[model samples]
Target: MVEQFQNHITPDSQWSTYEANVQSYRGLSMSAQSLYLAVGAILLGLGDKVPFFTVFVLAMVTTWYVFFPVIFARTAVVDFHKFNFGERFSKDGALRTAREDSKLSERAYANVLGGRRLRANVASNIDMPPGQNFRTMRQTRLKLDVFIPASMTVVWCIFAVYFAVFK
Candidate 1:
């Protein structure tokens, strides 16, 4: 049965569709980051009303600590989405570019997953850059580490707590 299925399947050259969850989570993170920046600004403006120093400090801290990383991280992911995976694999320069981009993508995923500890897995493991070793589908975005949204969420939560409890 498996042999028959394999024989029936045609190999087509097309970019595989990304899961909706992948895009959605990235969108959500971006939105949350924007909101935090906006609201934190407003709160800071109103800081004169109560415990002036505490309020101002908390607002600034929340803006810097919480909103900043989310904005940068999510923005990078947005940049990730902008990348043409197909271009990366093209005969022109996609292979070279993709290999280099893969290292960045790998680092982003690593930071989002097991933290810096996963550096060896994503960064060092991908050091060859295709000239020395062929690029694989698993290296592109198939790995389980692709979802760094979870890590961003954790950072977001910690910042939110600081805002709620102290601000």
Candidate 2:
């Protein structure tokens, strides 16, 4: 199976696809954040001209209804790629010997391992449940992706309530 896979797709191509998925995840996440900010600004600017309830509903719908689903999907894709690459490239995987035989210098190999460790560190969160050992890069990204929009949504709701009660 490994030979068949290698025959059909080189490690380079698989890595490239993984990198592309990571880039797409980042682009989508940033675009969503920008959209939230833009929508909030536009609605807030309309202040007295538009009903506060309308602004609140629009903000809630845009973040939760429109963006959350897409974010979830993108996160899943990136996670899949990350896991696939790890499984294929890990020490026990078929590609491990192939990668080890490559002409990378000792320093370069060390750097590569260091980079992997750094990515792992970045993925791990203190908030994670106890006894959960492995941490993937996607987990960290998923937290940020959901947390930012959730925070924005909460702020919008607070503003809406304040306006409804006092303004």
Candidate 3:
């Protein structure tokens, strides 16, 4: 397991990590939206049965607090890397990515899920301990991930309440 990501943690890894994170975050956000829509459909369809409004309100709360933050955090991290190190991406990136992947088995330890687990896996892949960029990536990824979800929760909760109470 450690051996798999041994090359993704060095200062040189910033670009690869950022690219991986950007791609992962996009998919995660879409998944969050899909989950929200699917669950909302099921709950709304219930209508008068099982106190559906209450169920929706609760589900929205969870999505706000739990689901969306996960996606947001990932986005913030990639955005930071892109903002500060935009040049890193432009120079020989595609070729580098191809070269990096050609090695295989020593890149990153990814799974069906992406986030903290993946960060740790990437860290473990590096030769030395993480530097400023790596640590910042993980910290922001952890901190902001939940913050965005909070706003989404509030907005959705308002929508749910409007329909349940006013509509």
Best by lDDT: 2
Q: What lDDT score belongs to each candidate, Candidate 1 first?
A: 0.40, 0.50, 0.48
* Per-residue lDDT of candidate 2, residues 44-148 (tens digit): 556652655555676567666765654454443344344453433433222334536432121211233244553344334223567665444246655666677
- Residue-by-residue lDDT tens digits, candidate 1, 30-132: 5655665565455545653344334444544554565445444443333233443222322222234524443333224313333333323332333365656
Query: Cα deviation of 29 in candidate 2 (Å)?
Result: 6.0
**Cα misplacement distance, residue 18 of candidate 1 (Å):** 12
Q: Write the per-residue lDDT of candidate 3 for residues 1-167, one digit (tens) a residue.
A: 54445445654665468668656764665466556656655665555534555556565655655545544454544443443322222222221243343322212222224434544534343345546334323565554454555565665576576557754
For candidate 1, what's the RMSD? 12.7
lDDT of 2 at 100: 68
Clashing residue pairs in all predictions, respectively, total 1, 0, 4
Model 2: residues with Cα > 4 Å off, grouped in runs: 1-50, 85-130, 133-139
Model 3 earns a TM-score of 0.37
**Over 4 Å off, model 1:** 1-50, 85-167
lDDT, residue 101, candidate 2: 48
lDDT order, best first, reads: 2, 3, 1
